[model samples]
Structure formats: structure tokens, C-alpha cells
Target: MALLFEYLPLILFFVVYKAVDIFWATGVLIIAAIVQLVYYKVSTGKIETRHWIFAGIAVVLGGMTLAFHDEQFIQWKVSIIYALLGLSILFGKLLFKTNLVEKALMGLFSSVQKEQEVEINIPNAIFNQLLVLWVFLFLSIAVLNLYVAFNYSLDTWVNFKVFGLMGITFIAIVFTMFKVYKFLPEEQ
Candidate 1:
């Protein structure tokens, strides 16, 4: 449910794009992003930093696309978002000695562990490796987005944005799970 909420804007954008066109879809994307932020604020009492950053990018780039009557601005949004995310992770680890990826993953699993009465202990070394993998993954996706946006049709780029990126992220998650499986306690 939370995962779906995170993706609501992208899902709506793809649907609206298929029904109408890029302009209408971009408008929908911007509105949906704002609505998602509002919903998070109202429900959680505090919106996450990533949500704020993503919504800001959506509004700025999506507004440019609508105002200028050019899809290039909207197309560039994906790459920009991914690039910033990758850089944040890289800098957070290198300069600040903080691992954002480790924090996020541990927070997620910790919640599940509390609910299921299970202890999942993934080593800090594994998380450090995972963080590096995630940084590379995000940067690669950013580069891939630019390549597809420039070399492919708008429809193709939209499909790649909605599906290809999601697929790649899913694969990465699966790979991470495999890497961490050895740490899980065996069931009797």
C-alpha cells in the first residue's frame, strides 16, 4: 500500500499519457505529485525529504513542459531526479560518513521484524556494499534515461520511464535480498 502510494503519480502519468497526450499527462503528473505530498503531510504529520524533493522537481519541470509546450523538459525530469538521488547517496557516504541506503533498508526491515517477532541481522559491511550498488544503479538509470529520451520516441521513452526503470529497481531489490539471505535465521 505504501509502495503503491509512492508510485501513484507515475502510475497516473502513464495512464493519462496513454489516454491523451504528453501535455495532459505532464499536468496530471504535477498535480498528482502535489496531491501525494499533501496526503503524506496530512496523514503522517511530516513529509519525508525525498517526497519534498521529488514533488519540487515534478512541479518545476512539469510546469516548464506545460508552459513552454515542449516535452524535453518533462523528459529530463527523470534523469535529473535519479542523478540527484545518486549524488546524494554518494556524498552522504563519502563526506558525511552516513549511509542513507543503510538507514532506509534497516528502518524498513526493523518494522517488519517488530511485527513478525523475527530478528534479521544484516551486517554493516553488507549494507556498505549495498549502498555502493545502489549508487551505481541510480547513476546508471540516470544515464539510461537520457539515452532513451534522446534516441527513442516520446511514447517509447514514457514506457521506459514507467516500466523499464521500475523493472530495473525491482531486479536490484531482488539481488539485494539474495545477498542478505544468509543472515536470516533458519526456520525449524
Candidate 2:
């Protein structure tokens, strides 16, 4: 799946860390991210903003970890990426009056509209609510990552990054689904 492809780098990093060492894992992660990005662009014929951001963080911070032999750089990558994501959502909504959630959903809506033979428009309320939810989600994840990184040992932080964070994100997705379900445009 596309989601799995997006996470290939992280998954590989976790595996490599278990098999070898953080230094080796960091190198693997950097290579994996670059490969993922190339494959994604080739397959999709388009590169998403998030893809660029992910690759950038992986290269810059992961490179630092590799070059300087400091695990801190790698630890900060998630927080930085999350912060940027949160800011992008807020920036889009506030400055451009753009609802990224709505924009993202337009493709699905188009398919539904074609099937139902009706027009569908997501209300502004839904957009605003989703935007706020996403901003909170991103910022919260960033803070949580930092909290774990600062407070825990390297092993513990790596565990948190790989498993704990994914669990939390899964929960957030479920919660967001429940919140947004009511706002879905119905077929007329």
C-alpha cells in the first residue's frame, strides 16, 4: 500500500537498529527515505509536499546523526517534521483561507459525485473543525516525541518512536474519523 511505502524508511530503521546499531540504522534510514521518495515519485508521477518534507528531514537530521555520531539529531527529526506539518495546516487555513482537509477530500468527493449524480460540498464548519483537529494532533505529537526523547534512554526512546507513536497516531485517526463522519456529504 501507499501508506506502507511512505513508512518504509521508518520501518527499515527500526529493523536495522534491532539487527545492527544506531549508526548503521541511521545510514539505512537515510538511504531508505531517498529510495522511497524516488519510487513514490516514479509510481505516482507526482511528489507530495509531505514527501519532500520527510525526505528533507531524514537526510538533514539523519545525516547529522551519522556524521556527528549524535543520536539527538535523529531523535529530533520526528518532532521537527510534526511541527512543520502542524504549521503547514495552520498556515494554509489562516493565511490562504484554504482548508487542506477539504482540498484532500475533493478527489473522493468527485468520485462520489459521479456515482450519485449529484454535487457535494463540504461545509466550512467541517473544514474549520478538521483543521483545528489536525493542528492539535501535529503539535501534540511533536511535544510527545520530545518528552519521550528527553526523558527516556536511547532504547526506550527508539521504542517510543517506532511503536508508541504509531499507536497514538492510530488512535488519533480513529478519533478523527468519528468526529468527521457526521460531516460527510450525503448522497441526494
TM-score against native, each model: 0.94, 0.89
In the range 76-184, model 2's lDDT, one tens digit per residue, is 9999998998898899988998887778766756787788776665578876887888899889999999999999888898899999989988997787667656655
Per TM-score, the best of the predicted structures is 1
Q: Give the top-scoring candidate (lDDT).
A: 1
| Alpha-carbon deviation at 90 in model 1, angstroms | 0.8
Error of 2 at 32 (Å): 0.7
Instruction: Put down candidate 1 lDDT per residue, 13-112, tens digits, no spaces.
Output: 9999999999999999999999999999999899999899999999999999999999999999999999998999999999999999888877867866
Please identify model 1 stretches exceeding 4 Å from their true place. Answer: 115-119
* Candidate 1 TM-score versus the reference: 0.94
Candidate 1, residue 88: lDDT: 95
- TM-score of structure candidate 2: 0.89
